[model samples]
Target: MEDERLYAWGNPWFRWSVVSFVVLTVLSFLVGFVVLPSVQRDYTAGGIWASICRAAGLPANWGAGTATDKAGPLSTSVVLAPAMALPGSSDAVGRGATIALQQCSMCHGVQGMSEANAPNLAGQYPEVVIKQLEDYKHGHRIHSFMEALSSNLSDRDIADIAAYYDSVPKARTAPARYSESSAPALVRVGDPLRNIAPCIGCHGGTDHKLGAP
Candidate 1:
C-alpha cells in the first residue's frame, strides 16, 4: 500500500515537472521571438534597455549579445528637445555637445579656434555661423569639413555651437602677401604665382560663407 501511494505521488510529480518544463521552454521561446527585436532596437536608442537587461539578467554586451536582444521586455521612447550644447539652447543641446567635441576639433581648432586648415570662427556673425553650421549639418554645405562635421549633429546642437562661435573674435594671424620681386629665381614653369590666391576667398567674407579659392 505504501508503494502504491508512493507510485501515485511520484507519477503526478513527474508529469507536473514535465508540464512545467514544457511551459518554461515555450515561454522563453515566445519571449525570445516577441520581445528581442524591439528590445535590441531600444538598446540602440539609449539607456532604458540597458537598465532592463541588467534587471532581467540579460547581457548588455550591446553589440555582441543575441542578434535581436530580449525583445519588447525593454524599450521606451522619450520625446527629447533638440539636443544642443550652448547653455540655454533648445532641448537639443543637452545631447549635442558631446558629439560636437568628438568630431569638430581637428581643423577648426578646439573650443572654436581655427587651425590653418580652417578659418577662425570666433568673430563670425551669429547668423552666418548659424547658416554654415546648418549647411554642414544638412548637407547643403559640401566641403569635407562640413560634411563630416555635420553628419551626426542635430540642428539644435549645430545652432548652439554656432552661437558659441559667434561669441568670440577671430584669432589674429599674419596676412599672406605675394611678392614677385622677393623671389631670387621666379620662373613661369617653376614659380609661385605673382599674386597669391586672394584672402577674400576666405576671410573676405568674414560675415558670409568662406568661399573656396
Candidate 2:
C-alpha cells in the first residue's frame, strides 16, 4: 500500500503554492515600486528613478546626485572659548560700566537687570555675552538694532561690556514652583528614542557643558 499524506515539491499542490507565492510577490513589487510611482505628478520632474525612490522610502534627491544645503542667514557662527570666560581687569570693568550706562541702560537697566522685556545680563557668563555680541556684529544673528549697535563695537569694547555685566550681582528670585520630583521627562531623563540630551546636561544642574548659557 502507498502512503498518501506526505507533501513535497513533487506534489502538484505544493508546486502550485510555490509558483503562486512568487507571482504574487513580483506583482506586489511592480505595483508598489513601478506602476504607482509612474503615475505621481511630482515625481515626473525627477523622472522614473526619483519616483521609484519615493515609493521605496528613499530620499527624492538620491537619484539626482545633489548635496544638502544647510546654510541660513541667521545661522550662528560664534565659537566659544575658555579665554572668553575669564574675568576682566578693573580697567575693563570700568570701561564696560561706562559703555553700558551710556548705551545699554535703556533696555538692559543700569545694573544689568532688566525691568523691561529685555534679558537680564547681570551675572551672565562672559563667554555668552561675547558670543552673542559677535554673532550680532557678523550678521549671524539677525536683529536690526543689535546688528547696528554691535557693528560699531570693537572686539575690545565687546569684551569690556561683557566684563562689566559679569561684575554685576544677579537679581535674587524666589524658589522654583516645581520640585525635582515634578520635573518633566524631557528636562530630567530626556527622550532616549529621539536622541535628545537632558536639558541639565548643558544648562547646569549636576554638570555643565561648555559654551551653554
Backbone clashes, each candidate: 16, 0
lDDT per residue as tens, model 1, 134-175: 665566656775777677767566666665655456666555
The number of clashing residue pairs in model 1 is 16
TM-score of each: 0.37, 0.60
Best by TM-score: 2
Candidate 1 wrongly placed segments (more than 4 Å) = 1-100, 173-213
Model 1 scores a C-alpha lDDT of 0.54
- TM-score of candidate 1 to 2 decimals: 0.37
Each model's lDDT comes to: 0.54, 0.79
TM-score for candidate 2, residues paired by index: 0.60
What residue pairs are clashing in model 2?
A: none
